[model samples]
Target: MTYTGDVQVGGPADVRELPALTICKLAVGPYDNNAYLLSCSETEESLLIDAAADSDRLLALMAERPAGAIVTTHQHGDHWQALEQVVKVTGAQVLAHPLDAPALPVPVDRTVEHGDTITFGAITLEVIHLRGHTPGSIALLYDGGPAGSHLFTGDSLFPGGVGNTWKDPERFTQLYTDVVERVFDRLPDETWVYPGHGKDTTLGVERPALPQWKTRGW
Candidate 1:
């Protein structure tokens, strides 16, 4: 089967394999939040992104290996509902941005900023801080070379548009600018986007709509 990045709560996770990493995307919690388990193919060491909710299911997915850390994309309550429990069970270090660290359930082991690199075994992910949705919302980047770049966008960038700004023009502008300059201009169009919820999309599919998203002020 192909990895389409289409997953639903209560359904099985979708897996994508790259040359050096394997990404397991599972949707958990009532909000349909997407949590990613990124494992190094060479070492089998893994990192879980978001924890979200449903510790049992997330733990089961990690039963065969040890988790090095859990990265909370932002301070949103829905995004970290299961963080405390999962940390208790796995003892994984919690990573988050400094601005959002105070809101998380567990104390953050490390505060990551833009351009920081998170590593486990042979896998390396670059952190991209995207504001507006939350002061410290972030996206993770994995450059797979020939396989193309992959972005774990959290609530920053999605299929339709950037994350909601609650009708605030200032916030909408900030988010739109960061996404366009830091993400759209920096990365290639083929970059695969795995959002915080729902299915996936690519930069190429969304580039043309940038103007519309800006004009709509969403």
Candidate 2:
């Protein structure tokens, strides 16, 4: 899928009847990792997903909203290099899975599990452990959205592929299976998947490719 540049900074898109969650996609580093800023219109609270790089621009976007917290999908440096700066500037608590907690630059304020829930006023986010790219990789599901369910899928799954795991063959396969069964299988067909990089797609659209992915033997 093709992304039409970055979603305009401050452009708010409402899901469900809840306040719009404005997402700003920051394309950073040589890998072009996507760091997302989830801003809640009702409370003006903002939560960042992956900090990546380009500290100045990332902080600038955070400063524009009521920065709330920083939630990482995993511990990969490409997705978390600017984390410390983001935390310091916003004084936002850092949340991550316990397994990836140590890889963080600072102590994690909150350790989230598979069934954990995060709420901002009326909106609630359900945590799903996708665990393929890394042991602690997770996906955040916003169920009350106008878009049905909105998934903030970190590096665990992407548009055309899953995250790279050339270092550990066994763990990589395990992660892939967890994502296919745990993440994709659990969601409804209409769920909107907002990945860490590339354009957005639905669970219904990507579900059919699972068998093909397994067959190819990545």
Candidate 3:
């Protein structure tokens, strides 16, 4: 499996034969949230991450790829405002954590949780629950291909800052620890992190910034 886009690929040499996953990041909404499209080369399977806003552009991106599912990182309206439009055009199954399912525009076909994995052809995505940004927030880990390991962090983690803890402070604290431990600590040092907003950064690069983040209580 050859992983394309921002993440690194790890695994056996045979896996290189697997189709590549292409990621297209679209900035939507006033907050400039990132909505992504993950497409597989071999099977032409695609997954949309965070519908956010701007349905027309999202649809146009889907038209260029084989869209199979829509996955929301959290339940915040700004992260899923255009969900209905994207779902209508792609006819893809919508997947989200059970906690955020109720906020989704349509019923979720797959309720993902920690340790749960979704496979589209040769590409397998491991779900990492990163609550705090939202009670049901999740980050996706693509583990196979030449691209190594790539993380779709949604609102949980960002380049210079972490997700806003607007609703629940306790949850945010828990999430901050979870992200630092589960995600930052567990993944390889070279792992690439594609956040819901702002520029992408590697786990290695973000690790050292934790102290600064802690100081700000973010």
RMSD of each candidate? 0.6, 3.7, 6.1
lDDT against the true structure, per candidate, is 0.95, 0.75, 0.79
TM-score per prediction, in order, is: 0.99, 0.86, 0.87
Highest TM-score against the true fold, candidate: 1
Relative to the true structure, candidate 1 reaches a TM of 0.99
Write model 1 residue lDDT over 1-218, tens digit each, in one string: 79999898999999998889989999997999999999999999999999999999999999986688999999999999999999999999999999999999999999999999999998899999999999999999999999899999999999999998999999999999999999999999999999999999999999999999999998
Clashing pairs in 1: none
TM-score of 2: 0.86
Candidate 2 lDDT at 118 equals: 78
User: What's the distance in Å from true for residue 154, model 2?
Assistant: 1.1
lDDT of 3 by residue, 117-197 (tens): 988866789999987888899999997556578899998888776788864668667877999888877888788888887
Per-residue lDDT of 218 in model 1? 88
After superposing candidate 3, which stretches have Cα over 4 Å from the reference? Answer: 1-19, 167-169
How are the candidates ranked when ordered by lDDT, highest leading? Answer: 1, 3, 2
Per-residue lDDT for 151 in model 1? 97
